[model samples]
Target: MDNVRTDKWLWAARFFKTRSLATDAVDTGRVKLDGDRIKPARAVKVGDKLAIDNGSDAWEVVVLGISDKRGAAPVARALYEETEASIVKRENDSQARKIYREPASTIKGRPTKRDRRQLGKAGE
Candidate 1:
């Protein structure tokens, strides 16, 4: 009988920085409740499963606690339990899908020993 709104809980649990952001994410089809679309004010209780797609990755977590007010990160950490699969997939997607720029290899073409010796005399 002591449940909170889905979006509000998401924000309280630190899934999103703000309640409005959580509501927007839910309204935009990025957040789901037990495989169904949910409104921002939908009541949520313990054990309810939520599937959220955060652009590059998706997550599935089971509700463990509920609150309407945002709290500290340490307190927020107790609100849900992210599935092992979600953690693995998210980490893999984050590592594999990222684009990295190596500063040492920024310039095009190969740098010869003479070029290496001069460091920046390529236009000569």
Candidate 2:
């Protein structure tokens, strides 16, 4: 199709695992079309620009095709083209993330029962 619902396009393009997830992102202001925030049902046509923020990462893409059905990564990739600046920025962000790993990731399994007891006694 020449155009499709924003959420459907997002899902078909493999941006989100499901249409509902894409719709939720759109509703929450995480997705924008043509530089303006839009509803999930908004129509997206080829050449339209989109900005998507997915917590740890963001993307800026130009729509190249429209489809309602999800497909392989290579096929889905044809639906949109990422901008050069977006690619550079994403790479920089990824590098920064690697250099500054989350503190939570360093923590191993949950505290043992003995550890919990010690913590409770220490708090007294």
Candidate 3:
């Protein structure tokens, strides 16, 4: 197809797990088309620029093809091509996050007794 709905393309490209999620993301301004915020129903054609922010990582890509149907990862990848600068920026951000990750955020599950005691002591 020459064009596809923004949400459909996002889902087809594997950016979001489901079409509903893609639509919600668009509604919430997490996705943009050609530098302007757009609705999920907006039509996207080949060569259109998109900026997508999914909290953790942001992507800047150019639509290389349009598909309304979700497909395999490799096929989905072919739907869009990320800019060189975007790739470099994402990688740098990832590396910075790894080097500066918060120690407290790394703790998973419930806190141990000692950890609770330490937290209590810090609060006092």
Candidate 4:
């Protein structure tokens, strides 16, 4: 295809797990085209630059191919080319995350009865 819908391209490129998520990201301005915020229905053509922040990771890529179908990871990867700066930034972010993790990430669900008792004792 010469071009595809932004949301479909994002899904086909494996940027998002689902087309709905891609549409949501575009609507929320987490995805941009050529530095401008665009609608999910916007057309993505070859050579178009896109900046996407999909919660955990951000990416800047140049469109290389267009497809509306979700495919294997290798196939999806061929749809876009990540920029060098984006790769470097993602790697640095990964390193930082490895060095320091969020304190709350260690906590799971609700505390057990024993844990609650210990917390109550500490408060006294």
| Top model number, lDDT | 4
lDDT tens per residue, model 3, 41-111: 88998989999987678999999999999888999999999999899999999999889875457458888
> Cα deviation of 89 in candidate 1 (Å)?
0.4
lDDT agreement of model 1 with the native: 0.82
Global lDDT scores for all candidate models? 0.82, 0.89, 0.89, 0.91
Report backbone clashes per prediction: 0, 0, 0, 0
Runs in model 2 deviating more than 4 A are 106-124
Q: Write down the lDDT that model 2 would get.
A: 0.89
lDDT of 2 by residue, 87-121 (tens): 99999999998998764464468977776676678
Of the two candidates 2 and 4, the one with more favorable lDDT, higher being better, is 4
- Candidate 3, after superposition: displacement of residue 62 in Å? 0.3
Q: Give TM per candidate.
A: 0.74, 0.83, 0.84, 0.86
Model 4 clash number: 0
- Off by more than 4 A, model 4: 109-124
**Prediction 2 TM-score vs. true:** 0.83
Model 4 lDDT per residue over 7-120, tens place: 999998988999999999999999998888999998889999999999999999999999999999999999989999999999999999999886445558887787677667
State how far residue 47 of model 3 sits from its true place (Å).
0.6
Worst 10 residues of 1 by lDDT: 98-107
Q: Which ten residues in a row have the lowest lDDT in candidate 4?
A: 102-111
Give per-model CA RMSD: 8.1, 4.6, 2.9, 3.6
* Model 3 misplaced stretches (Cα beyond 4 Å): 107-124
